[model samples]
Target: MVFTREKTLDRAELEAYWKEAPATLEGHPIKVLSGYGPHEVWEGESTEGVVIAEFPSMEAARAWYHSPAYQKAREHRVKGAVYRGILVEGTTPQD
Candidate 1:
């Protein structure tokens, strides 16, 4: 998830998004590789926050993303900030 806050439209809403998203993710086999923290833009423009979550498989990742609980939390995010998000499968090393 990559978030670029044009403006905090609603602090309360954003807070709710933050609070509810993780709770919804509980029990999922996901590993948070990176999340809200300091980062350097080596090239192009960067967003305010970048989050990378690793799952056992693409199906699992999609399941988490589209889950009803997460979709509810996502409502707050949509109302609160400008962002871009995508899911990409990682490449494995060649033998």
Candidate 2:
């Protein structure tokens, strides 16, 4: 969930979101090894930031998204920026 820096979210809060993200899955299925954010939106109607996550499986990913723990964090997320996510299944190269 990318929390655009609206009038509510400040730099410190965004930083806190980064710090607390690890606790979302408690270092189990979720792994966000590296992330970069808060870049200038030199486009049409872009958010203030972006966050990416990798999960062990699609089910795991969905679970984490709906989990109550993450839901609480989601509150902070909603106020922070534009929330967007997708559960996509990977595929091998076509033969």
Candidate 3:
């Protein structure tokens, strides 16, 4: 997820998001690879923040994203900050 700060963040909404979003992870095999860490953008447009997560598959990622619990949590996220989220398959080398 790539986030850009578009406007003043609503702290209440963000607090709610942080409180609720993690609960939606229950039973899902989502792995947070990187987030809110020091990093430099080597290319492309600079963003305010970036998060990298790994899901079992595209379908799994979609399932989690579209889940009712997550959708509800996402409401607060959208209100708090602007984000660009995408799912892409990772490359696996063949022997």
Candidate 4:
């Protein structure tokens, strides 16, 4: 998921969201490829933070996002920052 925050209305709320997010993925396999740092936009515009998480499958990713715990945590994000997010299926290269 990629998020672009146009404005941060509440830092405390955003922090709370992050604090609660990890518990939601307790049993799910997740890999963080990149995020939570400064980045240079080589092409189009970008947000303050960019996160890429690799899950076992698309379904798992979807479940995690839709789970009740996450749903609650998401409320904080909604109130914290102006953002845009998306989920894209990845492709595996074949020989």
Candidate 5:
């Protein structure tokens, strides 16, 4: 999943979401590829920050996103900042 921050964040809500979200990853094989940090946009509209995460499969990703724990955390994130999130399946390279 790729999430692009769209506006200033509510620090309190963001903090809360972060705190709760990590705990929810206990059973999922989710790996964070890129986190919110300094980024240079090559083209198109600019965004404040971006976060990229990878899951083993689409089913796993959906399970994580819709899980109760994550859903609870997502509420705080939604309140904190607007984001454009995209979930795309990646192709595996042939060995």
Candidate 6:
């Protein structure tokens, strides 16, 4: 699932958040594959930060979000901005 938070955060603080993210998600059930933000595109589509993660399972993904490591990461994100988040099920092929 991808999460987005609008332009509530300043550049410096957002950068700090980005810096702390990768290591924190390591060995977790949910893997953050990629994250990105618009580089001041000057478009009215809303400037926001985006995150994409891969989860082992929906339950595992939720668990990771509530875990202590993510909690720590959340602190910085909250300070930086306000966000809207969601989770979507991943596709799998049966054997």
Indicate whether candidate 3 or candidate 5 has the larger lDDT: 5
Worst 10 residues of 1 by lDDT: 1-10
Clash pairs, candidate 4, are: none
Each model's lDDT: 0.79, 0.61, 0.79, 0.81, 0.91, 0.74
| lDDT at 49, model 4 | 73
lDDT of 6 by residue, 31-51 (tens): 667677344546667746677
User: How close is every model to the real structure, measured as TM-score?
Assistant: 0.84, 0.63, 0.83, 0.84, 0.89, 0.70
Best by TM-score: 5
- Candidate 6 global TM-score: 0.70
Residue by residue across 1-95, what tens digits does model 5's lDDT show?
A: 89998885798998888899899998999999999979999998889899999998988999999999999999999999888989999986798
Question: Which candidate should be chosen as best, given lDDT against the real structure?
Answer: 5
| TM-score of candidate 2 to 2 decimals | 0.63
Check candidate 3 and list the clashing pairs: none
Model 6: residues with Cα > 4 Å off, grouped in runs: 31-34, 37-47, 91-95
Task: Report the alpha-carbon TM-score of model 3 versus the true structure.
Answer: 0.83
Write one digit per residue (lDDT tens) for candidate 2, span 1-95: 22234344555554565566658777457766334554667876765445566677888887888877777777666665545565666667896
lDDT (Cα, tens digit) per residue for candidate 1, span 1-95: 33345346778888989989989888788988888767776777666776777888889888888999999999999898876777888888899
lDDT of 4 by residue, 1-95 (tens): 55566578899999998899888878877787776667777886666777778887889888888889889999999998887777878877899
Weakest lDDT window of 10 consecutive positions for candidate 3: 1-10
User: What 10-residue stretch in candidate 4 is worst by lDDT?
Assistant: 1-10
- Better structure of 4 and 5 per lDDT: 5
Model 2 accuracy (lDDT, Cα): 0.61
Candidate 5 TM-score to native: 0.89
| Total clashing pairs for each candidate | 0, 2, 0, 0, 0, 0
Candidate 1 global TM-score: 0.84
The global Cα lDDT (0 to 1) of model 4 is 0.81
The lDDT of model 3 is: 0.79
